[model samples]
Target: MSLSPSTFETIVPSRYITFTFPNHHHHHHHHLRVAVLDSPSAATAAASTAAIWVPPGRESDWIFSTFSGHLQLLLTQPLSRLILIGNSPSSPQPISYNSSLHPSSPTPLQRNLAPLLSALTPKSAFLDDGEIPEVPLLVFEDEVVKSSIVEICEGPCVGEMLIENVELENDGVKEFRRRLRFKRMPNFVQSQMRICPKNVTSFENLDNMKFELDRGVLVQPYLNPMVAGISVISRFLEGRTFRPKALCLGVGGGALLGFLRVQLNFEVVGVEEDEVVLEVAKRYFGLEDDELIHLFAEDGIEYVQNLAKNLSEECRFDAIMVDLDSSDVSVGACAPPTEFVRKSVLLAVRAILHEEGVVVTNTIPSSKLLYERLICEFREVFEELYEIDAGNGENFVLIATKSKVRNALEANEGAFLNKLKSVVSGSYIDSIRKIPRTADPAF
Candidate 1:
């Protein structure tokens, strides 16, 4: 029976027992603590699943619910962890409950259980009715309670087995023949596998193949060796003094390093925030020590800030390239807040750039909002801005230059294309060039 609104208890157990609500402002501070509380009889039964609800405005509720849900669903037999269900007023979404019975009409509680739902097994079924089943279920609504379930899965499987089940009929064989015919086209290299049937009859023309595999041919795109920090230091004073230096803010593994080194030949300095990535670059990527190359382990913005303060007036970098975060686009409702990007990071970048220097940013193609915001911020600091569209799926590079790039298309076009070719390689550069460039200022 539904409880009357007047008599219903407004207080519910908190999803996070250690931290309080809304005031826990720092996103990084709220830790999700989950505890599995099973029924006395099922104490030995693995607690596999858990559900949590978060209210609006309470930071702890959101943190616990989302993170705990991820942890619970990742465990094997997560259904056993079905321990506690708690609520908070700060939650914007309804709470999700796990039940094998009544799969369609599960009751919507005033809590956020999205984290658990995300971690739930793809095969796991849910009960539709509002009522908690005879199966173990925990329900609470508050900001200070840690909810969890018992662990069931022992360890993750080391490797996955590949199972291919192909059933080819007469029509499928005919289609395969057609594919083989297409592969015989002049443009199609015979070394590229032609579709063939499993039967011996399909090998009739195998001896006619003339092409050998070209080991020298690079099929994949060129990758930067220095993933993060990329800087170009120009020389003056008859090769004795340093002139304008350019730094690439957040390079990934020095994919851009090859281009800057070969084309500009400027003293390149790369800074990376992740220590593990830096080590990986050194070990796997061909990053070497030289007079032009310097590496540092530091955050991009912090490094720039320090450089701005310490570097001599003539020693400041003339250009800076930035590519931070894995994907250019931000997804989901719980994406990192906008303030962090607009204020903290972007502002710091502008603060460090030289007045006459340029800041080139590589961003995801689909993230229009982020691109616009970046342009707006750059416009505030620099007078000239140009963007190069590397096509869809490929990343776009924005060149925010202080020096009015004289006849950008004519002057820098050759250098830009050559740099792109050297860094990205032959076939990759061709593919990138196939994508048209748009000069829309809004982009």
Candidate 2:
């Protein structure tokens, strides 16, 4: 809808319409721009050349033109992949304008478009079959089309669309091409920082990912459900008489460790097996190496087994927060060596967990209506279990506690949620406060 100040103008087909046009009432401002490239090298300086922003639903809106006069770009459909040729759309004739042609002359442009018109041309590597190029496209409120062009999401990926590739004269003038790449603004994280009013939500996206990756800052990335779940865990630990000692399984971005270490001042130890995960958490998410926050790289199951065997009653932990999702082999703690998930692994965890301590876990169920086997087993182990519906999808934050929460259980859902708001921190605190009364299909 809006272009940045740095941009000056767009070349549109004569038939195309834009609000800036005199008859603004007939069309809206949302526009689609297309570019054709002769070669990678020729694509440079695309901005100076004219471009048009095509408004949807008008035939006159899409008029391919002779821009740059060097390259002709053809599109059979609305551009998922491009078939580039050196010949003009008007004629099927071959034009081989080699490197010797100067910019002022039309020879170079004609040459690039001429030879490669056929798919079988040797030089036509640009039009390779089975090549799915990640392209940039904008889909705002207004659009008139069945579905849309391939690949457009605000986050979790990045790409650029190439419009022009300049193939210089035979002597090799500086090669150039024009590409449009878009960066996703961290609006969700930034806006949260401004309004959340709590330091916990200020984890990975606390700053731009580029900056966080640069500094390797130890902050949790803002996962909506994960954030709320962590807050609920923190609230549960708030009432402990002793300083809470927390164990985090599967260091997801190391956000939980950061929160427990800085926000709750808990004696924290984070266990993660994947070397790449720890490396990325440290390098990109700013996971810190400090005395208060310790990280161990080993198989989560073996580590727990070792802890259960070695530690005495005095060494039990106040809270164990398990967030191992990616696999279903073992839900409570990463794939729980199949033998352990049956009972031993959980019993081992319970052995080291203090009598009044709590275990909080994030489990992705097989179905929203179906309860997971691990949580079902957890009910068999712990005396009191509370389930919080994350409201995102099938994410369930199950709280299994050693101490009885009669007060919380006695109070109706509304009263319990009111108590939760008072106990937890951040906007997400409210989201996880929604505790489910009954299991949809108790396994």
Candidate 3:
């Protein structure tokens, strides 16, 4: 038999409840359940309330069933009421009635499910156990107009009723179909994933590719080319002049190190995982004929471990710059585990940095938690910390020094900005001067 869309609705006394729906699409009445919570609370209470939604099925049921069970388990007490709406025989009304009567009363379920619910639905206001619950009316519609439940307020049948039902030709299905059509186009493919180095080369030879200083590469405070580019150069200069050796981890395209070599004339040993990127840089990024630029095709972490084991005090680098992937964006839009930031990569950074040397890294500015953890870790090892903005929604650089340095920018701010202005050929230096000296707490 062909499965047809059907809508079912009901009402229960408890503030929390779940309704299951049969999945006829797969020749089975898959139990789909939705749980409604009046408030938010801890896990224990939410779990007790969610237990009611589990039907006589194993853990590997339909998608909806599994989600409902997980949601049930996550809801704790002190949460508000829960309303489970689904196509099952036991599904409840999509909307709850008389929820505003206990304005000050707290529903444990609502509190616990607030974050997930907020992501799925519109914002809501609820009263604390001692506060007021902000309840609003909502409409419901589904495929196949079979049944509905309306919550009635005061005055018998004359009060406001919450309506939940399905339509024979569901509007949702039409929208989905429309979206799928757009997804079939070629341009849409580019939006899904970033262009890789090979594709970039295929589109245009690396030598032919022109680097422009567009808004994508420039932003406020970092507009001063000298400040943005030279600070890096000056840091290296300080290390090279004083200690005379440096190492870089995850050097992509060698643009950063190349800039340092050309502008500041500093020799840098760079390790890159992708030989293609290194080759492209050498060919196109003015890296050719620069003996100061040394390229290594090795994993950055492994390189650090080897350096630690093989390098003596005299052979150790005076400074190290790391620009590894902190998230999918840096790693070509691939989501990495949190451990990548917390342990593996961080340990590698520490292993390579000299005893009294400096280590600089590029990381997203919005990741306050990660930034805090990094700062905490550095505090245990380094004597000073500094950060600089690179602008244009790009990453910020964190500089940790083992020795006392007045400031990373030092006296090179003006000269560096002037140099960058010469290279990018823009008046961005004026805007860069306005950036507050204080580092953003979020970074």
Candidate 4:
């Protein structure tokens, strides 16, 4: 069962999980049992299996169950009351509740569950139990894990460092900020990045930037699915040049630009309206200006219109990506804003693309009506449209092409994945494979 991202903030049916434990306040000995319900159907059927008892020694076995796998993630949630099913065949009562539930006082269940909760608490094998300090670690890919708050933009965009083994002195921290580069990262830090635990210097023999890009590493997890355009375009690029051309609408942190340029060897042109974001990208995100990389500080919609008018077919981009967000999200248009999704603007964007080129947009619609409206607008310009739900129930990545070749992409799926594997590590592709993917909505 899937848990909603905002499960704790609101109490909606099938959104929250229920935990059950046998009443232990009495002296009667009984088998320990754990029940977890993640959906409405499961909650309705929980009573039948609520009293299923396990042997005394088998309690540890339940920790490996499907529900246990998500328990660690639960620790980060603002949980409400947990239903405690007593041994008596009566309705359960809330033994304890979170602050959000306006809890009254502790109950007997807290005493019984204390040991089980302690066992479930995550513990580091290398670090001691004593108070560990949070140190500013190095930057991996684009994120500055658990480090001091470094403001990248005036908006909510920022970076912080993750805790690691080595503690840096003030001079070291200053030096890191000066270079804005570090090659070594601890095992735990690597784990936090969801990468294999290894000395980052292992790739010292090769270009470090290429190494990360080849592995398909992106700063934001949602962007991974957004770049599925690479695979879409690969199937039809039989006679095209090995290095494709890409147009990036938003260059926040320059992660997508760097990924496109280094991974696919694309000649990338990045456009960002905010000059401060460009400077921050250069200063903090290691965005370097080179012959293959072009940076423009202008409005994305106007740039697309100008390019459509002046750019030659030979200079057209193979892929156009939109990842910008509106400053005022109260209107519910977050990514690409309302202007970028306009039919006229989208047609202009399509005019400056290769015949086989694809347009991928990152959209975060505030309401169902807005999302449907966005899709209808997209359907007006492109003949074939594919969508990938960012898996967070919030962000969505839409891939649109002028031609009808969805079947071709499916037939070449094996080849496409193989081609990607040749460029990136197999494990990296496997990790991104978990991203929820959906076909066209039949618009």
TM-score for all models, in order of appearance: 0.41, 0.45, 0.42, 0.52
Q: Model 1, stretches more than 4 Å misplaced?
A: 1-244, 262-264, 326-356, 365-367, 412-443
Please provide, for model 4 over 309-420, each residue's C-alpha lDDT reduced to its tens digit, 9 standing for 90 to 100: 8878765887898887765412322565887888889999889988888888887775667777787788888877767666666677778887665453453445534665
For every model shown, the clashing-pair count is 57, 38, 48, 7
Q: Which candidate's lDDT is highest?
A: 4
lDDT of 3 by residue, 195-302 (tens): 112223332122232232111121122223322433433444442434245676755435556555555445688886656545544533334435677788777767
Every candidate's lDDT: 0.37, 0.42, 0.40, 0.50
Candidates ranked, most accurate by TM-score first:
4, 2, 3, 1
Query: What ranking of all candidate models by lDDT puts the best one first?
Result: 4, 2, 3, 1
Give the runs in model 3 whose Cα sits over 4 Å from its true position. Answer: 1-245, 283-290, 326-356, 407-440
Please report how far candidate 2 places residue 418 from its true position, in Å: 12
Candidate 2 residue 64 Cα shift, in angstroms, is: 30
- TM-score-wise, the better of 2 and 3 is 2
State the TM-score for model 3.
Answer: 0.42
Residue 330 lDDT (model 2): 13
lDDT of 2 by residue, 326-431 (tens): 3321121122234445578888878788776677776655444335566567767777666566554445666676655544433324432454344344554543
Q: Least lDDT summed over 10 consecutive residues: which range in candidate 3?
A: 175-184
